[model samples]
Target: MDVTTIIGLFVGILSLVVGFLIEGGTLGSLLQETAAIIVFGGTIGAVIISFPLKTLKKVPFIIKYAFTASSSHSMTTVENMVELSNVSRRQGLLALETQQDMYEDDPFLSEGIRMIVDGVEGETIKDILNREIELYERRMLSIGKVFETAGGFAPTMGIIGTVMGLVHVLGSLDNPSALGPAIAVAFIATLYGVASANVIYLPIFNKIKARLDDDLMIKELQAEGLISIQYGENSTLLRNKLMAFIDDEVKSESEQVEDVNVNA
Candidate 1:
């Protein structure tokens, strides 16, 4: 599990509760079953209506992965790519088949190696890998859109719930003393709607987008590295080229060390 996602979500919820308490609000006042059902149920119904069942079926997996830790293994990938480049340069392209097991966990790298081992043209390899990246991103973005749709509908559902509550308040005007509390209870649906949209749904959507970018960068790097190996590029040159994909700070420090070695 990704602890940051858990921590961020916890902190967000706690902030709301703490802020409410600071404002002299009672916790019991926030626990309205009617408001919850109205806001959450309506929001869910809206999302279901907006998307197909096949798309909705992926929500559980999408939500699970949003909280899951994803590893880029960028440096390890570069190292393996460099090693494969050297192996191919010295022995032959067929030698990469023996090293394929090392990349079994990374389907992108493993598949790229397999294609090259089978003598797939470098251009063809690049095209196939790029196409896979495009399709994968499309699917992930579609899943992220589910949360986006929910976030968009939640506020409106809240307003609907609040209005329904207010209509009830209007019917109970005989008990004027209860008006203030009743109005407050009616607004709780609005709170649930707004809070869930901003704190939960939208944030998860953005998290999935951010993860997509990270995963794409790693995949692109693998694609480039694999293509270079297929073309029998020099291992040193390929390493230098791939190192550019690392973070700027790491790349700068590595360059400085290289300069010192050259001067020595």
Candidate 2:
């Protein structure tokens, strides 16, 4: 589980509720089942209509991704690639086939190594893996777009709910005493919509985009690492080349300070 995501969520909710309590607001004043049903139901209906049912079905899995560790394997994968490069240099490329079990933790890296061991041409390997990368990117984007669509629809749905509530209030103008609370309840849907969009849906969409970018970089690095090994690039050079893809991640704080000083 991702502690950062959990902590961030807890912090966001706690801040809002604590501040609300400090302002003399009770939880009961904000708890409106009708407003929740209207905002969430309308938003979900709009999202389902916006996207295909098949893609919507994957929402739970994609949302879970936000609360989980990133799937980026660039760091470990570079090490593995360097080891494979050494093996190819000392023994031979074909010797990699015997070491398949060693890379069971990462199937994509293992598959790339298998291609190199099978003596696949550099161009052919690049073409196949590039296609794989493109397909993977499209799939991830589809999932991200689901949350994107929900975020887009949520605020609009909230406004619609408010309008519906106001229409009812206008129809019952005889109950002037109920008007104040009715107006407050009418805007709760808007609050729910805006809060859900900013706090949940949009955040998840952006998180998926960032994670997918990292994942694709790892895949691209694997493709290049495998191809370089197949072409018999020097092991040290190949390791350096792969590590370059993740420069920001590998840079130490001291190196970052030096960079800041240099830029200054």
Candidate 3:
């Protein structure tokens, strides 16, 4: 589980409640079941209409993954790519075929190595890998757009709910004593819509987009490593190239390990 995401959501909710209480509001004031149903139900319906059914089907997965850690293996990827370069330098491109299991878990890495072992030209390999990256990005953006659409519709839905409530309240304005409570109830729908959109839908949309960035960076690194190996670049040059994608602290640690291994 992603601790930061969980904590962030909890803090957002708590802060809202605390601020409401500080302003002389009661928790009961925010608990309008009819208003909630109107806001959320309408928002969901509008989102379903905005996107294709197949795309909406991915909403649960998108929400789950937004709070989940990415599966990139960045440091391990650098190590693996550097190792492949060393192996190719010592042997030849055909030698990569015997070590297929090293990249078996990642299709992008696996396919790149497969193409290299099959003697595909460097330019062709780069083209195919770049295309794969582009398609992957488009797919992720489509998913993120679902949440984006939801965020856009929520506040509007809130206003719609409030208007409906006011219609009913005005129709029954014969009792002046009930007017204050009725007006308060009428605005609850708007509060539900605005709050859920800002705190939930918008945040989830941004989170998913950020995850896509990390994923793209990892894939780009794999593509670079594969093309460099095809060129039969030496391990030292390959390591430096991949290190550009890593953190400075991690680079220092990797260099220290390499020095220790060489000295021993």
Task: Specify the highest-lDDT model's number.
Answer: 1
Instruction: List, residue by residue over 105-212, the lDDT tens digit for candidate 2.
Output: 878778888888788899999899999999999998998898888888889988988898999899999999999989888988898888889887888788888778
| Candidate 1 deviant stretches above 4 angstroms | 250-264
Cα lDDT tens digits for candidate 3, 1-264:
667778877898899999999999999998999998888999888988888989888878888888998876667787788888888888888899887876688889899999999999999999999999999999988988988888889999899989998898889879989888898998988888888888888988888888888888889888999999999887888878888888788778877988999999
Ranking by lDDT: 1, 3, 2
TM-score of each prediction: 0.93, 0.91, 0.91
To one decimal, what is the Cα RMSD in angstroms of model 3 from the true structure? 2.7
What C-alpha lDDT do the candidate models reach, one value each? 0.92, 0.85, 0.88
Clashes of each: 0, 0, 0
Model 1: residue 136 alpha-carbon error in angstroms? 0.7
Q: Model 3: residues >4 Å from true position, as ranges?
A: 247-264
